[model samples]
Target: MTTWRDVQAAAPEFARRVQSLFDAHKHKTIATLRADGSPRISGIETAFTDGELTFGSMPNARKGSDLHRDPRFALHTATVDPVEGNEAEWPGEAKIAGRAVHSGSIPDGPDGDLFRADITEVVLTHLDDSATLLVIEWWTPTNGLRAVERE
Candidate 1:
């Protein structure tokens, strides 16, 4: 179970970890729902703006189409071992629970598509080289990501 208080406390740390992996990891997997209740997944290079997340893709992609129909989305951002570096492979994952809605009229470049998700739940799990694995989970009132006051 996760509480708003915990989320408030951990959000800064979470943001830092995420930023570390953003360009280095370069790949994020997003899972969305199909109309028939099946799962659709895709790899995306995510962009975060004003606390909202967005990505670029073809209009026909399953994720884009699914968002049109279902609007719900889940994002998993993970890190892999670097080829050679002083940086340790701190495997971390964040679960983003939010609704996907079309943001722009024109589909071009980074401005192509926009998804404003009211991330309500963020569960960050990481394997620490110096310490044991750590897991932090946070939840919102609606149970999943929706509109909620930021900490």
Candidate 2:
């Protein structure tokens, strides 16, 4: 399992950009697997602190149950549509796919359950400076960062 710190060490600039996009919004989304192996998408918020990525769920929340039953998850940063004539000002959206590890028990706390990400991949997608081609970049624990531009 790779930590967010490991991703940072592997690709600092990419990590910084990814984190910025996450920080730009207060809410994001997460995809978890259901008992039937279908996907359940839910609204979520993330924290990048203490050199780790973390999120929480209300007690007995479906998402929490999903993680416990199946740790695999894909988290996405909230996105804002690019201004029609100001595409260059739109920061790319970011995504992270990995397993969710129980950070710890709340133990009489009101925050419900907390989990840390064991990242496998992080991706950023945006338009090029000329706002023509789309640029997609991804970083993995083993592969580092790679990019491709598409028209």
Candidate 2 residues 26-51, lDDT tens each?
Answer: 99999999999999999998888878
How many clashes in each candidate?
1, 0
Judging by lDDT against the true structure, name the best candidate.
2
* Per-residue lDDT of model 1, residues 27-145, tens digit only: 88888898898998888777764555666556677788788888877778754653345334655566666676677643456434566665556655554454343445444544532
Q: What is the lDDT of residue 44 in candidate 2?
A: 91
How high is the CA lDDT of each candidate model?
0.60, 0.92
The TM-score, computed over Cα atoms with residue i paired to residue i, of candidate 2 is 0.95
Clashing pairs in 2: none
C-alpha TM-scores of all predictions: 0.68, 0.95
Q: Let me know the TM-score candidate 1 reaches against the reference structure.
A: 0.68
Worst 10 residues of 1 by lDDT: 142-151
